[model samples]
Target: MSGIGVLREGPLHAAVKDLLARPGDVTEVKYGRYVIDLVRADGELVEVQTGGFSPLGPKLDALLDEHRMRIVHPVPAQRRIIRVDANGEVLSSRRSPLKGEVWDVFDRLVSFPSLLAHPNLTVEVLLCAEDHIRAPEAGRSRSGRRRRDPGERRLTEVVGSEVLASPADCAALLPDALRAEPFTTRELATAVGCRMILAQRIAYCLRGMEVLTDAGKRGRAPLHVIAA
Candidate 1:
């Protein structure tokens, strides 16, 4: 509601943009042939990206050379499922059992792993609680029953944040146990309490940032060692 741009953006994106707005910040302004979400009075660029980092890759490549940019990506730490009818009446509400962590950013960062080494870039993981709204779809399915489609996410409260400003910050995401020894992705997974895929992404990003390098192999799995 802070700017006319809110009318076009999704509820969650607009909410976070307004939350980050300062007194002299410009919202939804066009600069250097791209429409940025917000720009501070001192000319700092703020981008609130709620999806994959792939699409933002070119924009960063285009602007990072001349400006300081902060990319804000929100991870919902807690979610409340809200079901509503076609008439916009709330039907039921429940809490989701799944929780999100700061490490989830690696899932998106894989699109541009080396960007972390850029001196002018900062990636902030914003942790928040939000409403995951669902509404009935227009038509019936094979069983003649209506299906519920996910709607926009509505922000409830911001809980915390993690700032990844350098390659060292990326390396710190690994547990201490993995720091001193060469390890495989499987071992990294166990150390971080995450799935093999997530662990692989973390390693991929770290290696791209020059924080880790190959150190031969442990059996068939390739081994990685902390860079000296």
Candidate 2:
């Protein structure tokens, strides 16, 4: 085991870590330059990455040569915002109107599109319910007076989780209308109900995973189709 212990993890990390661990498996195993999150019963390495994937690539590349690795990343399906005072007292709590979908993971996946293609790698995207804490940011209100600070948001809880594995799983996220059309970032955005930038990322990852292929051009936008 590495010097990093489960007891030291934050609210979200610790919760997800405990959820992924089995009865007899290990937590925080030191493997070469990295400290793995969990070592499963069959020697599979489970990594719970709560942040961007770009920095994880080199470390994973080193491990995947001989080990089976799974990247467990969480996407909050439902989020509650908890406002706290400077002294850490809870002020108010409310649910954010925006609910997250599994498709949202593409936003982060765009940062490292190639990882989806690693043969020895499997990704387990966990859709979860979480609480976000913040101190009001310093600013003025709509009336142009000094406004209460809305603090920086930090993850404070993990309420639930589910897995999304394989490119087929991601393909399922495409809406029926979009799945039938030649893929364009615009069509993808409309289908997924996300911004074009995020849709572009999803397309990039799908392409890297060999799930989509260039199907020439429709007007100016490059066209794509599900890979045959």
Name the candidate that leads on TM-score: 1
Q: Which stretches of candidate 2 lie over 4 Å from their true place?
A: 5-9, 140-165
For model 1, the superposed segments whose C-alpha errors exceed 4 Å read 1-6, 136-148
The global C-alpha lDDT for each of the candidates, from Candidate 1 onward, is 0.89, 0.76
lDDT of 2: 0.76
Clashes in model 2: which pairs? 135-150, 135-151, 136-149, 136-150, 136-151, 137-149, 137-150, 137-151
lDDT of 1 by residue, 98-142 (tens): 888898999999998998888999999999999999874458889
User: How big is the positional error of residue 11 in model 1, measured in Å on the Cα after superposition?
Assistant: 0.5
The deviation in Å at residue 117 for candidate 2 is: 3.0
